[model samples]
Target: MTSDIFAEWLKRQGHLVFKTKSSYWYSQAARTFQAFPYHRVIEPDNNEINEFLKEHNGVALRYSTPLSAKYGKISYHVLFTQSTYSIEGLPKKARHDVRNGFKKAGVEPISFERLAVEGWELRLDTLIRQGRVRAETQSAWVKQCRSAQDLPGFETWGALVEGKLVAALIAFSGDDCCSILYQQSATDYLRFGINNVLTLAFTNEVLKRSDVSQIFYGLHSLDAPDSVDEYKFRMRYTASPVRQRVVFNPRLSPLFNPLTYSALNAVHKLLPGNPTFAKAEGMLRFSLQGKKPLAEQDWPLGLLEQKESILKQY
Candidate 1:
């Protein structure tokens, strides 16, 4: 797959993205650059990172490096290895959910246009459930999905109950990696097990491809609760190990040290509710913690289990 398609998709969403020797870095949260594809562990030379920062007016650049590489916080890629994926292989409780979901909803590939028009409600429900309604607006969500329309390598899948969309996800098929992005399901349908059915069916479908070898659930989230990805783990995705690096502009590096992170974390805890504040605190915390050796850093929960499955393959 042409990786540029993902970058193009992001650009169409009105975000600025730049390319370096190692990967495509996109502007996020009004001032930060985040590397995409989620699975790429890059080795960017310091000079290049410095040059990019200089050119971008010193916006922070965040990317992942191998655990053995220098400077980053301990985090996981949260992935599923491509193998014989089946509901029969899922844990007992999850297997039950998938079975029930299949009985209740129809899983199928839908056009991005349909997602743009009908996905708004599911998106809203999801954000509301997560108390992240401020993270995205309905118009923005529709525009984002609509922009991916007809984009190659981007696929839309949904679990429909009585022909109404209850759960949906947008999967980008990168060469050797299928990244699942923007997954949301209606809260009421949790009983119907729509998320289980959609995740299982979509994941199985992607793994069937001979070229794709892994499915990325997402990065260890910077702000959301761990339980968000815990669901994916329940559905059989491994929290694959990686070091998420936050490369700050030299001029601003002083503001991101341990003391600053500690103070920010304390303030955010008391403030609560605002996503910008929460993420700002999380990012600073990651930047500070990542500078230490892995032995000294606190690892994200479950990051080691089945991690070798990806370290060996990717």
Candidate 2:
């Protein structure tokens, strides 16, 4: 549940781990350092950032920050922070689907090893459905699932239909929060509302624990479609406003200025479905947008209630 355990899990899988004054970070694609415990909202001061960058040389650091942060892009985190959760608390449509999903599938915790062997096809179907088959190959997926087999704080839950795994999710429980890392379902069973059932099941289980205060679904994607988070919203999760900052080293920071962002923004259009260009454009756009005054920044529309408590920290 501690940051140390999370870092150890990633380290065992050969990911480079960095411990900072506030959080644990891991090097991911394109030499970017992603802060983890994914629920934790960290606001790294300039001194901490400079120290880390000096040690790492060239790398980008991305993490969720408070909405009142002076620097960083406005972003949203998908989270369920209700004091209590139940099927009755869900909306009419979600309530109906969750009930049906339960009738059609049995939801329970499964061994990570079992998930590794039986969850491959589920992962493939999910990637294909999301048009992101390039995200992970079969071998890579197998290794990822198997790597968490004996890791503490990590649990795998699955929804089974007549003994066949139809949907599954991997969640990490921290001292006061539980983060859902991955969820995949059989596309053919979408009509059965299996994924809804799985989300509801795990979310409820986490909430039942007196020590847990929230269930973090994940951060809103910078490159993907809005429909991705829309589904979570429909499942009764709210869009928790936060600033997502992308920090580059001193030497490389200039390359991501307004000129470069505009050029890449235009380039991504001609490139069609290029994820790299798409993400770069997003990062630059956020950085630029974050610099504006608070009122000038666009809010999450209806996704967030702009109350003083949620908008301003003070």
Q: What is the TM-score of each candidate against the true structure?
A: 0.93, 0.91
Model 1, 1-314: lDDT tens per residue? 36789889989998888888888888888478888766888989899999999998755888888877878887888788857788878899999999989899999999898999889889888888776777788888888888898798888999999989999999888778888888998889999889999998888788678989888889887888777888898998887678888888898887778788778888888877677888888788788888786667766776755454544553
Residue pairs in candidate 1 whose N, alpha carbon or C atoms collide under 3 angstroms: 72-290, 73-290
> Which lDDT tens digits does candidate 2 get at residues 1-314?
37778788788777899888988889876777788877778888988987887787646778889877887766788888887778888889888889989889999999888888889899989877775566666776677777777877889999999999999998888868888888998999988889889998888788779988888888877666676677798888988777887888777887778888878989988874666777677766766777776567655542446545555652
Instruction: For candidate 1, report its TM-score.
Output: 0.93
RMSD of candidate 2 to true structure, Å: 2.3
RMSD of 1: 2.7
Considering only N, C-alpha and C atoms within 3 Å, which residue pairs clash in candidate 2?
none
Model 2 lDDT vs. the true structure?
Answer: 0.80
